[model samples]
Target: MLYIQLTPFPELHTERFVLRRLQQADAPALLDQRSDPRIMRYLDREPDTTLEQTTALIERITQNAADNSGVTWGIVRPAATQELLGTIGLWRIMAEHHRAEVGYGLHPDYWQQGVMSEALAAVLDFGFQTLKLHSVEANVNPHNTASRRLLEKHGFVQEAYFRQNYFFRGQFLDSIIYSLLTPEAAKPELINEAATEL
Candidate 1:
């Protein structure tokens, strides 16, 4: 079985952004994204219409980290104000199986800008290297071509497609599953290059 520890809440940094813990202060920004129809369209959950809802969501994310069941990061640009541009996480952890599910959403303003790709690369590194996960999976709305493309760009392959497997908002929805497995070994040059990038 895999062992996991999320204490101290790992804060990851890439060239352009910082992946840090979500806080109550971030509720408003998060609400803006969660309440936007464009951002929430592919997500099954209802739009968060109130600050209270977003705050509760942050609280749950905190609890999940404390419980070591999951970890979520608010993606923030380092050079700019410390407002969240998006959010990402590894959840639905199956420690015995050394696997977890990846989920994310960005404010529409930040879309198509490679912001999520950077965040995802950092998270995947943490999931595989620090958490020792053997594989990571993503379940996406079938119509979310952008998400599918993003996962594929990160080396995730389509593992399965379930037709009308999800019931949401009075409709049955199809889901596409994508996955990436930890490589058996890292090439020396690749390892050194990754070391420098981080």
Candidate 2:
């Protein structure tokens, strides 16, 4: 296996967005996202009610990268504006296993525009090519049809079904796990999908 460095942040670019490290200035945008019901629909945690919480979250993400355990990026489009539209990241990174769990959150206003599809394509490329990961997984609420469709578009296969095994906001939620192998991470169709308007 070829070894790859997982530490030290790197910036990624897509046709319409830039994926980069979370910064203090991003707290407000993150706070807005977390507080929005539409954006937090399937998320496990409560809405971030304060900028301090968002700041702390950013700090933890930075520390996780430093420890080589995880990486998170804020998605921004330069020509459109500096405001963040969403976040994408790898969590529970098990280097020994050559795999990681991926997660993302986007403001509802930007949904169905292909923005996330674009951002995730770039992230998968970094994971498979740069980080040398064998596979990437995503866990989603079964009811999150949009997220499921996005994963499917990128060649991710449903790998597991956990019925009511997760509790969020006082309800037991069914979760589905989806995975994409490194060999299939960057397919031509996915690249084409990323170019669509977002």
Candidate 3:
């Protein structure tokens, strides 16, 4: 079994952004992202319509980290502002299998900027190097082409497609599963190349 420790709350940094712990003060920014239809369209979850709901979501994310079940980071451009531009995380961790699922969303304003690419690379490194995870997977809405491209660009390959497997908002939705395993010694330049391209 894999040993996990989230007590210190890992904070990751890249050239342009910082992935830090989500805090109560981030509720407003988080609400903006979660409520925006463009960002939440493929997320399946209902838009967070109020601060109370956003706050509750933050609490849950915090608890998940506290329990060592997951870790989420508020993506912030520290050089310009402390406001959150998006959120990303590794959740549903399966310690015994040394795996976890990756999830993320960015504000529409930051779209197409490669911000997520950099953030994701940092997180992937942490998962494989620090956490000793063997693999990481992502579940994406089939219609979310941008997300699909992002995962693919980061070395993830499509492993499965489930038809109408997720029920949400009175309709069934299809999902695509993408997965990436730790790079072998011979192929040492996996995520690093992707990160540098951004």
TM-scores for every predicted model: 0.91, 0.87, 0.91
* Candidate 1 displacement at residue 92 in angstroms: 2.1
Candidate 2 overall lDDT versus native: 0.87
Q: Per-residue lDDT of 1-198 in model 3, one digit per residue for the tens?
A: 998999989999999999999989999989898889999888998898999999998999999999999999999988855788888999778999999999998999899999999999999999999999999999999999999999999999999999999999899999999999987532748667767899
Candidate 3 versus the native: TM-score?
Answer: 0.91
Judging by TM-score, tell me the better candidate of 1 and 2.
1
Query: How many residue pairs in model 1 have overlapping backbones?
Result: 0
Q: What C-alpha lDDT values do all the predictions have? A: 0.92, 0.87, 0.91
Q: For candidate 2, write residues 150-196 as lDDT tens digits.
A: 99999999999999898876888888999999984468887678788
Candidate 1 RMSD to the real structure: 6.0
Model 3 lDDT at residue 110: 91
Question: Which runs in model 3 stand beyond 4 Å of their true positions?
Answer: 185-198
